[model samples]
Structures are given as structure tokens and as C-alpha cells.
Target: MQTHPPRSIQLVAIPLVLSTLAGCASPLQPQSSSELQRSMVLAIEREVDQAKAAPERRTLSLQTDLTKLEIRPDHLKIIEDEYSVDGYLAQLGALDTLDSPGLAELLGEDLLGQPTTMVPISLENAIHASTGNNLDVEIARYAPAISEAGVVQAQAAFDWTIFGEAQYQDSNTPQPGQALGGGSAAIVRNASQTTSGSVGVRKDLTSGGSVSITHDLNNNNVESSFFGATPVPNPARTTGVTAQVTQPLLRGFGSDTVLSEVRLARNAERGSVSTLRSQLIATTSDTERAYWNLVLRYKELVIRHKLLQRGIEVRDDIKARRVQDARQAQVADAVARVERRRGDLLTARTNLRIASDQLKSLLNDPNLPVGSEAVILPAHDGIEEELGFSLVEAISDAVTNRPELETALLTIDDATIRETVAKNLRKPRLDLIAQARLVGLADTFGNAYDDTDANRFVDDWILGVSFEQPIGNRAGEAGVRSARLDRMRSVVQYRRAVQGIVLDVKDALNRVFTNHTLIEQSTLSRVAQGEALRSLIVEKELTNAGYSIERLNLELNQQEALAAAELAEASALVAYNTSLVDLYEAMGTTLQRNRIDLVVPDANQLAAGESPMERAGDGQQAGEQDAEGDE
Candidate 1:
């Protein structure tokens, strides 16, 4: 008798076999792919949170006293109302005493050489217009919709599909008469005709399986030559209904493998949204910068104009006293100063025109196209008030809100999705295929179908497993390795993006602080220069008849100095405002800070005639209506 195996060995072998079979059921099961991606993202976010939690990251070492920098509401009012030609002359206590003729002719007309229509626009209006109509923003708007379409296309892979086919055949063949029992060898003919058709519906499952149900029909008419054969139905019909399923147990298994494309497409859609947000932020910041520069140019033009008026006055006084004490050299000096001022005024006008055009380009308003001759007169001036910020909060906001960081994080997610798919691909392909059929045959198609339906049928069943694998699997291994590397690269890129955003926020804050300080210092300088100019003018008047060349030169120098001081103060103020814009952009809060809400229209909304980009404010609505009306 054959000896039985030891009980211990048998037990071990049986469990091993079962475990092997169970392992084959699902060889590659991990956490949900989306959860994996989210976990990785959270890890990165935790790193950022830790960075923000550091004690040193909370406060900034600021040079300017934050409280002392608070500006009065009426601080800019005097400049706005008293920085004109008559205003300056009155400020210098010479409004009624100075006889400055031809000042209007000297100041000249519009810089563009044509009559300019002044269009007053506020910062909010410019931002609103940009959000709706800026060309860069408009171009970026379609990306998310296109990426969403890609997601739809990828999902279509699992949609149910209907299929059908039909075919006809006629054939003739020769057979030996001996095979038909003719005794002598002779050729005989056999003829046949057949018509066949099948129809089916199949669906791909997210679990990496496909199932189908089909109905088959065939009709045959045949004439046969055979030896000792009984007569059979000449015209016969065969019909059947079959169901089949194919599922992958190894490679291509699971939702992660099957839905990889869909996940990638979704990631792309999110990335495109981030890209659009970045473009909007950039456009808004640019528009704010241009607007403030326009304001600065306007103020500079005023300063230049007043300086020219003062210069002309000095030249006229010198000419009027030329015979008394003004030498020819002194007259020449005064005239030269006036001419120089005139040149400066011309330069200032050109700058104003340029700044206006820059704002128009960014706004892209149909009512104020870049090529228009109209000038944009800023209705709002730059804010001079100092603002305080927490470095930790700013960094936290940048990490949370920056779209570039989001896009980079999405890149990592996409790479993770691809890596999951690649690792699945490395598994050997093991498919479980199953099929069942109810078959029937009769002289007619209707009978054949009825027989199958009435249980007078032959039932067929098939169950099988097929496995295939490359000996080396080099391609699959390489794919997995490459995917891992890509994920690593994306992580690095994400870190780089975070660092870049933090740097931007810090730099922006520094500029804001510096510019605020400059504003205060420049204001003091302007005030002191104004007093010095007044003192010089008073001294000259006290010795009006005993005026010397040195005194006249001093007067001219003091006027120029005052003008420079005024320009410095205005430039510093504009810079401070622009720095605030940059700060908001760095923190990804420009739209929120400006009280504008960005609304990205979906494909359905676009089809319904909604604007591609919208802002939730009166300015945007009014701008859109105006644009449509213009069109």
C-alpha cells in the first residue's frame, strides 16, 4: 500500500495551496488611489503648516512705526485740490502780485495733439474690466472647459456599447462518387448556402471586466453527397442566446487601473483651473500697477506744469529788471531755466499718455480700447495709510491660496495616479473568462428560437482562466520605475513652488514697508523744500531793488528743488500702493482684497451665453453690459 503523507505536511501543503489561490484573486490591492493622492498632499501641507508654526516666521522686523504711519483722510485732499497752476502761485503768495502772461499758451494743449476725452475710472472698475475682458484672462478661460471635456472622453471608455453584424455565403465543392457508395470512382457536386447574423450589447466595468449578451441566428440550405447517410433537414435554422464575462485577476485589475485615465483627466482639469486663477491674479496686479502709475504721471504732470510757470515768472521778472540790475548773463540763465522746464513739462505729458494707454490695454474695455485717443483719468488715488501684516499669516495664505502651488500639487497627484497604473501593469495578466449559451436547431428559424425558449435546447457552459507574462517584463518594470521618478520630480517641483511663493510674499512685504517709509520721508522733504522756496522768495522781495544774480539763481534753484521734492513724494506714494498690490497678489488675495469675486463659467453656462469670466460686483456687470452693447 502507498504510504500517506504526514499530517503536518498535508496540513501545511493544503493551506499553502489555498493561500496561493486566494492571493491570485487579487495580487495588487492597495489603498484607494485617490486616498493615496490625498494623503501625499496632506503630508506636503503639513510641512507647510509646520513652517508657518515656527516662532520666527510670525513677526517681521519693521523699520517704520506702524501706528505713526496712519495717514489722515484729508492728507491727499490738499494735493488734489491745490497742486494746480493757480494753486501753486497762491501757495507761493504771488497769485495777485505775479504778472505771468502767456502761461496758458506756454502750458500747451493735449499731449496727443488731438482733443482727448477724459474717462474717469476707479481701481475697482479697472479690475472688473480686466477680469471680464483682459485678453490673457480670456485666453486662459477655455482651458478648464477643454480639460473637462477630456474627462468626459476618458469616462466614455466604460459606456455601454451596442454591436451588430450580418454575413451571407454560398459555396460549391466536389466529392468522389466512391464516398457516396457509387462503386466506381466519379466526381459528385455538393452545394450549400448560409445566412448568419448576431447582435450584442457589451459594457466595460470599472473593476476591469467586460460583460456582454448576444443573440445569434443562422439559416442553411444544403445538398449533400455521402455514403450510407440518412436524410436530414435540408433547410435548417440554428439560433442561440449567449452571455459572457471576462475579468482580469492580475494586470489591469481594479478601479485604480481601469479608471487611471479618468483620474488623470480630472487632475488636468483642476490644473487648468489653477492656471486660470493664476492668470487672473497676474492680470489684476498688472492692472493695479498701471492705474497707480497713471495717477503718478498725472501728479507729475501737474508738478512739471507748475515748475514751468514759476520758471516763466522768474524769466519775466529778470527781463523786466534787465536794465536796472539784471545782466545779460542773468537773463540768459533765467531763459535757459524756463526752456528746460518747458522740456520737462513735455516729457511729463508723454509719460501721462503712455501710462493711460497701458491701463487701457490691461482693462481691454470695448469702450476704452488700447488704440483709443481718450485718456483714463483715475478717479481714485493711491492710499497712503500704512497696513500691518503677520508673516505667518501671509505665508499660510500663500501656501493655501497660490494657484501655482495648487497646480504643482496636482502634478504630483497625476504622477501618483500614473504610478499606480504602471505598478498594476507590471503584474502578469490573469483573466477569468466565463460563458453560457442556450442553443437550438430546427427546420425553421422560429422553431429553433422557440425550442431554445421552451427548454428543448442544448445548454453550453464554459469557465476558464488564462495567464500570460513576459519572461523579463522589462517594459513594465521600466514603466513603473519611470512613473516613480516622475512622482519624485513632481514632489520636488511642488516644494520649489512653495519656496517661490514664500519668497514672493516676503519680498512684497519688504517693498511695502520700504515704500511706506519713503512716502513719509519724501513728504517731509517736500514740506521743507516748500518752506525754503517761500523763504527765498521773501528775501528777494525784501530786497527787491537790490536783487543780485546770485539771489535770482538761488530762487530758480529753490523752485526746481521744490518740484523734485513734490515728484519724489508722489512717486513714493504710488510705489507704496503698487507694493500693496504685489503683496495681495503674492498672498493670492487680490480679488478678495478688491472685493471682486471671480466666477469661472462652466461649459453648460457658457452654452447658455454666460460670459467666460465674471466678477460678482456692479462694476463687472455694468462693464459686460456695456461691452455687449458696444458689440
Candidate 2:
């Protein structure tokens, strides 16, 4: 029996094969994690970004991608399950040239039939999905509601409360005077009963007054014998309504003090809402940046793959040499070049995978379960055009609209309100209190009520004053001092934020202009390298006159030029696009730039609303567009 190491282990053995090439097979040991990671990145880059098929070649050219790459049954299942069946079928159709009926006999069961669809991701979709679903954005969205609830809680302190009470009592007592009278009349009994009910509403006013309106009704019955003369009993009922109000004559006498907590809550709510917007802005920026990075990595992988192919072609050319002048040293150099390009291609592939994973994380859509392990194909591709803006105007816009600045301003307002309250609270406590009551008395409850309504009740008025002072008023004094200091701090913070944003805008603006210039220069450089490589090919004609070293030099020069050109093109694409992301972030307008407005209505409003997130990323896409730029 024989055992084999892991496939990835076999891949790293390419280096070890050099030593064993003197014979046929020498084994290499297991590779380290870092080595594996590098190989994985470069391999993917070479295959995808720098593949042999350009946008035009992909449609008509015969491809072995379906055969070369192992597309497991499970990968097909996951993709098809997520996307439409027809879309999956179309994707499978594109990869499987063997599916044609005549070719089936040769390809056997390897031909694809039902394909899986994978949701393709675009930069626009990524940003929108992140706003609606990213964990950070979702968590931050609750801040406004929490702060609004806090405001409600603070205002509850002054809400009116209705109160009611009812009670009944009975008592009996025996008098000793009855014993001195006679046997039958010896023991005289005294009995009494009373019942009362009251209902009222009490409220604390924001204007520094406390008031209550109450209605009271009572019924009493009494019977007694004195000196053995006689006994009389009757039920007496009283009904009265009373209203009382108290106002602060000095301390706590205005909205500044009485509604201070409510004011603070409202200001805090503004700050919280602004903070939430800031979080969303940051999330949008991150998602955009990650999406573009994925694009760059994909393209870089393509470039690396192309270079590796070129190196392999050169090595094959050397191997095919039939002339006596062909040297072993040239063949060795060609072999070395191929290995170098292959290693680089593998590393590029791994980094591209990393970039894709990052974009998936930012998207964070629940339905997109492929984020865990499956490959994601971007929805759209190709270089994008940009719109320019004035630097001075951009800086002004950032300072005016940045959420951080708004939050700071709100904080300062909150502090100012607190300072006013604290200053007022430091005064000695004094209040003027007053009350009014109407009393109705009668032998029966009905008569008492009638008297109260007929203007026959007695009118009673009461007035009073109260005053108190804390021994040192230390807490009040401290509150005032703290509030003042806090206000100053908030103002400073707001100023600092303004200065920082201005500087950031300037830095981003410069990068945008610089990267744009580089994009143009890189395009020219790619063309120039291509020309230089062609020149080397033309020089091969001169080498035919027996200059063997010149032939070797020409091949090496052409390969180097080709590699440099591809790298420059890929780098230019990344730089120009990423600089745009930086510019958007500096202006603090990521959400706006993406046309993503999460300042959304609540559930009820959304249900009744006219709009939903456009181009929102939902599930794992079904069919992937070709790796080339979107059609």
C-alpha cells in the first residue's frame, strides 16, 4: 500500500523537484503555514487575474477551466441552492464545452448539466447591504431610539398621576356609669362607624409648581347614653372638593431648573442620532474600500498568472531547442524564471482570496451564506470613470456636514442647558404654597352633594410659605463648576474636529490628483513595455546570424518587459480607484456618495413607504458574470 501527502503539500514540492530532477522523483516534506498561504495567494492570482483568456477570448476560445479546476458536487449544490436554477444552468453551460451531445461519448460523465447560480457582488450592492446589515451599522442604529427613550423617561418626572382611596372602620365601647344607674339600664353601650372615599390627580409642572385636585366624601354614625337619660344616633355625610397649588418663589422657579433634565435628554438624543449617522458613514466607506480592493486583487492575480504563463512558454521554447548551439545554462535560467513566476502567482491568488473575504464580511447579508466558504464573483468590473470636485468647496462641505462635528455641537448645547440649571439650583430653596376647598355638610349624602352644587357650601382658603438652605450648598456649587468645565471641553473638541477634517480633506484631495496622474502614466508605461518586448522579438532576426547569446538575451528581456507591463496596469487600476474611496471618506459623505440613505423610517413607515434600498445585496448570487469586465 502507498500513501500520498496533501494536495497543497504536493504543490510546494515543486522546489524540491529541482534537486531530484537529476533523477526522476525526489520527495519534499510538508510545507509551513506561511508557505502554503503564499502559494495559495499567488496560484489564485495567476489563474484568475492573469488568465490566458481576455474579455474577447473568453467567449469563443476553447477553455479547459471546467476540467482543470475541481468543481466538487457540493460547490455546485451550494451555488444552485442560493441562486436560480436557470442561472446556474447557464453558468455550467459556459464552463462545460463537453456538454455538447457529440462530445459526450469522449468526456463521459464529466460533462456538466445542472449548474449553480452564485450571487454576483458589485460595489454599489456591497455598500447598500452593509448599511442595512453590517453588525456595526445595525448596532449603532439603535442609539437614536435609546436616546429618544431617555428623553421620554426624563419628561415622565412631570407627568400627572391620578390617585384614589377608600376606607371603613367600626368601634364599640362600654361605659361604667351605667352600672351605678340600675340593673336593666346598668350597662350602656357606645358604638361608632365611619367610611370615607377620596380621588385626586397630582402633577408636577415644568413651571416650578405642584398641584392636586381632590374630591372627598365621608359618612359617620354614632350612638351613646349619658346619665341614663336617652340615646340618639344619626348618619352624617360630608362631601368636599379641594384644589392645592404650590410654586417656587425663588430657587427652581423656571423652566431652566424644572425642565433641565428634559432639555438634557433632548440634546443627548441629537448627539446620539448624529453618532449613529457617523457609524453608518464609516461603514459605507469601509464597504466601498473593501469592494474596490477585491477588484484590484482580482486584476493583480490575472497579471501574475499571465507572467507565469509567459515564463513557462519561455522554458518550453528552451526545451524545444534543436540546434547544437542551445546551452544548458539558458535552459536552467528559463526553469528558474518559471518557478519564480509560479510562486508569485500563487501568492497573488491567496491575497485575492483575502480581499474577497473582506468584502463579503462587509456585505454581511444573512441570505448570502456562501460568505463562509464559497468563491464570490463580482457582479460588475472594468475601470470606472470619476467626477472631479473643487478642493476648497469640498473642505467646506466636510466641515458643515460631518456627523462628528454635529455631535460635538449638540454636546455643547446640552452642557449649556445643564450650566443654566446648575446655576439656578445653587440659590436657597423657597416656595409659595396655596390651597382652596369647598365643604358641604348635610344629614344625608344626597343633600351634601346638592349643597356643594347650589353655592351653599362653605369656601375655605389657605396660604403658606416655605424656605430651606443647604448648609454649604457644596453639591449645587460643584454641579455649576462641572457644567461650566464640560461646556468648555465640548467647545474645544468641536474646534479640533473642524481642524482635523480640513486637514484630512486636503490630504485626500492631493492623493486623488496624484493617483489620477499615475493612472495615465501607467497606461503609457504598459504600452511602452509592450513595444519594448516587440522590439526584442524583432532583434531575434539579427540573432539568427549565429549570435546565440543575443538570442538568449532577447528572450529574457521580452519576458521581463511583459511582466512589468502587466504589473503596472494592475497597480494603476487599484491606485486610481482606491484614491476615490479615500476622497469620499475625507469628505464624510460616503453614504451620500453611494446614494445610500439609512435615515430610514421605522417598520410601519417602511411598510407604507415608497422606497426600499436599491441594488441591495440579498442572497448568494446564482450566476457569475465572466471574470472580464461586466458586459
Candidate 3:
């Protein structure tokens, strides 16, 4: 009637039935979610390579990308409550709207966006901020320039100077006659005009000393009642010249003394630059800590969500069973499930709030556009292969690279230099001064150069040695001793710092190695628990029983295993990052490998001491533990 089935149709029908029978007999293929996560983790490690290569951006953009990673609404619900439904929906909607490349595009836009505000500033900015704006940057910035100006002022001390003056006067000459007559005979007058000029040359001496020579000339005309009866008379000229020198033999209270202060100022300036660099380091470190805290909180929230989802599934199953079982055992199971989910949700919310606070503090801007459903993807997932290097080698690298240690060592050097300078200063100040001058006295400038005869050339010089023990040389000796002690203290501190740094490296290395092992063991445990759960479910289904001893035991065992895996995962994530922090801190360098901008400030530029603001005036420890805490 159907013109006989086609041979191809027959062949397909036969195979279809056989394939169905084969599929029914086969085992389910494993889902391999862990493998997928592992692959993603590997991708992250590769991304870190890029981050290290381009640290100038510091991967804030990458963090944004990570936050944009989509988790289903149900997944989000497990971590949050009904109150957070809108936020979860908003995040999902954003992810959907962006499509495949949306996250990357958003991050790129944020990272490279044009700055809305810009202001011209420099190192002066730091100084002004530190000084609370009352002190102008010019004052501190130009202090060295001003001190240099002192050298110019001292140079003027070596130059010659000339000055000129003129005066006119008129007076009554009949004072004697007026005195005798009691007032009437005062018509006669006397008048006079005088002009004067002087030239001097001063010389600065080599050993904290100076000397000078001076010449003066004057002319005047006068008329008197008793002498001339005329108002004007022939001018009379008078000239005088003198020379003197003073030398210091004890204290350095002259030109050469300037060297000491200049050296100290230069050192101080260097220290300022170091201080700025240190501030920059501190700022970056704080930023990083905030960022990682945000990341950790996100990971914890993810774990809570997983736990919540499992609880929900268990609760639903328990409720369904209770409908048929009519037993308190099923009710208890349902209650336990509800409690677990509720507890997980609360913990997740608390963690989320803490993370948000940390991130907000770091951004330092309330107006920043953060994603509604921000979360940090762990840098890695699952156990990774154990791989590590020697702690001793790590410590050696730390000592060589740590900037704080380097600064401390340089401080010792600076102190030692100061001590040597003090020792040199212990000797009494001595100086020799000499001066040569050509002298002439006349009414005019031309006349002043008229007496240049070789024999008349006045040459005066002095050679002397001065010594003052200062009764005890107390100040100098005390300075030397104190500086030496400081130098010694610095040396000791530097060694101690080295030891501490070594310990830091060792601790980080231990964590890394231990974490690797934990990860491996935890993975095995998780796999075993999953298998045991599956076996228990199969057994329960076959028996068609409720709250049986075998089923309860299996459930309890699986839950314990799940708890262990959760704890291990949390520890692994925290330790992985904390170890990295310790490593970086020990090295005192960023993980970035860029060599383009090679400029680094000298140790002198580091901050001299801890800042008051960073100090804990409240005298409370952030990480203090309870008395019952283990050592």
C-alpha cells in the first residue's frame, strides 16, 4: 500500500532503535564544570602576564571586566535575598545588553576615557599638602636656591666699593659780637660747602676669614668774620687712608663655615624626595589592599551562593518527601536546609557590604559608576599543581630588592658621613689673610690714581694660626658621638630588617607550597563526596525509603565533605593572594616588568620617619585577636 518502505528508511529505522537501546545502557557523560573553571583560571594567569607587562594601567580595567562576568539570576538569588532581586536583575540586564564583547568594550572605555578635570601640579603639590597650605611652595622649594644666593652675597664681600657725598651749610658769623651786644650785631654771615668720597676693597680669605683696605679724600671752603671777612675763600683739601685685617683662629664663624650648612641642606633635600617616593608607595599599596579585599569578598559571596543553591535543592527534596513520609525526620531535614540557606545569605550580605566599603574607600570618589552586581572572580579555581622554589633564594632576592631596606642602608651611610664631618670639625678653626692696595688722596677721581708709584703701593698681609679648645670641645665631641651611635643603630636596624624580610619570604613560600597541596587534596575530596552522594541517592531510590540509616549516614558524610571542600577553597583563595602580597612586600617592588621608565628616586628621597597621620594615635590594633585565640 505504501509502495514498500525505501531501503534507506529501513536502514535508518533499524539503527535508530539500536542506538536508543545502546544509549539507555550507557553511563552519563561527566559535566566537567571544574575543568571549565580550571581553563578559565589558566586564562587568568595568562592575563596576569599582560598585567605585569603593562602595570601603568594597573589592571583596574581588568577588574571591571571581571565584575561584568555573568552569573544567572538564580545564582545571584542564592547569594542574596528577595530584597536584592532588583540589583541582580539590573546586572543581568546589563550583561545581556552588552552581548559577547560588551565587558571588554566597557572596560576599555572606562580606562581610556578623557579626564573631566585636569590641574597643573608638581612636587610642590606634595610639599604644599604636607605643610597645610600656610607655607608657600616657593619658600621650601627655593630654600636651596636662597642658600645658593648666600654664596653670591659672600662673593660681594670680596669686591671693592666706592661712595660719594656732598653737603652745603650757611650760618651767622657774628655770634661773638651778638653775645657781647645782647642781640643786635648779627648781620655778618659765614658760608661753607664740603665734598667727600671714599673707596674700599675687601678680600675673602680661604680659611674662614676676610680683610679690607680703604682710602678717603675731602675738600671744604669757609669764610669767617675774624679770619677772612669774605663769604668765599680758597679751598683746602685733606686726605687720609687706613688698612686693617682680622683673622679667626678658633671657631668656624666665617665664609668657610657655609660649607657645613650647605651640605646638610642638600642632604635634607634628598630626604624630602625619598619621602615623596615613599608616600607614592604607600598610596599604591593601600589601593591594592582595598582592591584585593573587594575581590576576596566577592569570592566568598560566590561560595555562599553555591552553598545556598545546594540547600535549596535539599530543602525542596525534603519537602516533597515529607508530603509522603508523614515523619518528623523529613521536617527536620527541611528545617536544616532552610537554616543553612538563611545563614549563607546573611554571611554573603555582610561580606558584600564590607567589600563595598573597602572599594569605595579606595576609589576615593562617591560618584564613580560601579556595576550594580560587582563581584571579584578568584584569580584561580580548584587545586593547581604544586610548584615552588627555594625559600633561601627568595630571601636573598628580597634583601637585594627591598627599597625600604635600601633606604635604611643609605641612612647609615649618611649618618657615617655626618660623623666624619663632625670629627673633621673637632679641630680649631685657623685662617691666613692677605691684601694688596694702591692708595692715593686727591680732590677728584683722576687725582686718586695719580699716586701709583711702585714704592708707594701699600701692601698689607697677615699670617696667623688660631686655636680654641672651647674649654672641653664639648659640642663637637658630643655631635660626633651621637652621629656615630645613630650610624651604629641604623646598621643594626638594617640587619634586623633583613631578617624580618627573610621571614616574610619564608612564610609566603610556605603558604604557596601548602596551598598547592591543599588544593589537590580538596579536589579529590570533593570528587569523592559527589560520587558518594550519587551512590546514596541511587540506593535510596531503589529502596524507596524515607530517612533510612544508610541514606542519613550518606547525606551527613557528603555534607561534611562539602564543608571541608568549602573551607579548603576559601583558604586556598585567601592564601594564594596573601602569599603574593607577602612576596611583593618582601621584594619592595611591583610585579611589573616594564623597563621603559627607569627613573627611580634615591634613598635620600624616602620619608625620614613614619608620618603622624598613619600612626595609630587611638592606640588600637586593627588585627587584634581575642584572648582565647590560638597563638
TM-score per candidate: 0.80, 0.70, 0.55
- Model 2 Cα shift for residue 612 (angstroms): 7.4
- Candidates ranked by TM-score: 1, 2, 3
Per-model RMSD to reference: 14.6, 19.7, 21.7
Model 1 residue runs over 4 Å out of place are 1-113, 172-191, 223-231, 319-333, 454-460, 545-547, 613-631
lDDT (tens digit, per residue) of candidate 2 on 159-276: 8999999999897878755444455545657777889999999999988989999999999887666653332326788899999999997788987778878877877777777888
Worst 10 residues of 2 by lDDT: 1-10
Q: Which is better, 2 or 3, measured by lDDT?
A: 2
Q: Which segments of model 2 are wrong by more than 4 Å?
A: 1-119, 152-158, 170-192, 222-233, 318-337, 370-374, 379-389, 454-460, 541-565, 603-631
Task: Candidate 3: list runs displaced more than 4 Å.
Answer: 1-292, 320-340, 356-388, 435-440, 449-467, 537-543, 546-564, 589-631
Pick the winner on TM-score between candidates 1 and 3.
1
TM-score leader: 1
Q: Per-residue lDDT tens digits of candidate 1, residues 486-576?
A: 9878877876776788789879989988888788788767756666676577678887542566777888888898899888988887898
Query: Candidate 2, TM-score vs. the true structure?
Result: 0.70
- Report the lDDT of model 3 for residue 289: 48
